[model samples]
Target: MKPLPPTLRENRRYLLLRITPATLEADERELYFAVSDAVTALFGDTIAAEVHTATIVREGEYLILRCRRGREDTLCTAIATIRSVNGTPVHLTTISTSGTIKALRRGIRAERKGNSIICTINEAERTGILYADEKIDLIRRDMKGQDVVFLTKDDMEIFHATTTITDGI
Candidate 1:
């Protein structure tokens, strides 16, 4: 067989970390830390610096971590955006109101859209209600025959979706 490319090899190694769920919360935290540490150890200080922006998502019993490391220009713009928003009451108010309206519309649309759609659950997943980019709205879980109301909104869209948790390691 031909040798795998370097990127594929690296991705394969990364995929190895996705395994079965731990029984304890501490174990889960430890696993997350270990994954963060491993990324730093394998990719050096640059990768380590970007780890803070990473998010660990939990869907049902599975855990996944998503990392986004940007280039210099992207990082600079992000920093600038953060700094610009600091202590700016008017700007903050405008952003907040716009975001809230967008989220409300998305929720309403999602509710009217579909039911029981399949979703891939990685380590960085979030359950209950999810508001995305102040636009798209997705409801992650809905159990049947149970009084479990995962999402509720008077003027929001609600869509049904299923989450599939897979073992990696």
Candidate 2:
């Protein structure tokens, strides 16, 4: 009998560093700087050197950042994105939320209840949902007080906070 070929798996390690929540009215850019500084301080000049990309996504009520590393086979080569709510900066590492999500898409339980939806996201992912509806409302208002983007009942299952209309007038 022929043996199955060994599948190549990337040998990579990641670390998640979470920051405490700060005040709500704090500046977002400033908070990002602080979180970046903290990440640099924690990982030093070696592993956490390159920051490939950073993106902000709305999860439930909170804003989550996904930071992608340049390489996948290095120690401390990971992403760190943060959200500042009520003057609090919550740092979420790629390993904790993103990794977990990648591991168990079905394991992370979620269900809808009436007008509200309940998702069994991890404690860290929960950060993404923090202040979710309000933040989206703020963003919508900031976008000219139009209902172009909204949170609907179906969005609850996907953990997405904002919805947009590209074809509608």
Candidate 3:
């Protein structure tokens, strides 16, 4: 048996997306169904079949989707438009896209201190605990390896840590 030639082989594109309001757990099958349904509903089955999606993986809060090249626009649009999964409202935000798996595997830029990310809150090395009613929002990314996470004093009912910088992300 022989592998297909480079020219004859299909070109693939990878899309990185984040699911917000992390109320639901990561399930690839359900995510796939949601994405497929969204595409079908938006552009019909013809376009969905044409997209030639190979695989979909849910890593943490990120959903990495691999599909045929030249169809990234369609796939990205479908992912962005998907409102809910398993009755939980999830907002999908595109993080990055790549043509190769190696490139796609490279995630957020940060400095690693042992295992966990070197998170600093209020200019302190060790921050305090978070309350159940607290809302942690992104203040701003000042440097390449430093991330400033602000735990707002606002009392919010629904608070979700939807994004996390991790391995294989």
Candidate 4:
């Protein structure tokens, strides 16, 4: 069979997801299933197939999901509904979506060093605080038990103080 031409190839996007409950095992298959179920339940099999999610990478607390280019919004919606994987309560936070993997990696790296950060309290609800332009002090060596998650600009705004963002959500 002849391979399709470059122009005919499908455009894809890579999404970076930050996983919470960091203690849970990082199993690619389980992560894929949780994502698959969320999309299938929300949009049915037709849209689910159209999305074509692929779990490309799983680091300590990060997951790189690949999906059809234009379906990023759909993917994000599905991701938001996910509550658990393999009965382990978890949170999936969408960091970014990029058409190229190189760009996606760069964004994730920037996040690791980015000035904004979210500090999560060690509790059942896992309360979090979104801070602007600051991170180093919160994660200092003396603060041995701190749980922090780096976030993107969008996330920063979403999790920002409600008292300040009085504008319509």
Residue 143 of candidate 1: its Cα lDDT?
52
Alpha-carbon runs more than 4 Å astray in model 2:
1-23, 51-61, 69-96, 99-169
> What is the C-alpha local distance difference test score of each model?
0.31, 0.35, 0.64, 0.70
Q: Any runs in candidate 1 off by more than 4 Å, and if so which? A: 1-18, 21-28, 51-53, 69-169
lDDT of residue 39 for candidate 1: 49
Model 1 residue 135 distance off true place after TM-score fit, in angstroms: 42
Q: What TM-score does each of the candidates earn?
A: 0.26, 0.29, 0.64, 0.63
Mark the 10 consecutive residues where model 4 has the least summed lDDT. Answer: 160-169
Find the candidate with the highest TM-score and give its number: 3
TM-score for candidate 2, please give it: 0.29
Q: What's each prediction's clash count?
A: 14, 14, 0, 0
The weakest ten consecutive residues by lDDT in model 2 span 121-130
lDDT (Cα, tens digit) per residue for candidate 3, span 41-156: 99898999989765567766667888888999998888878887776567888788899766876874332222222234344332222324444434232445323354543422
Better of 1 and 3 by TM-score: 3
lDDT of 4 by residue, 14-129 (tens): 99888874445659989999999999999999999999999988876788999998999999999999998876568999999888777877655433322223333332222232
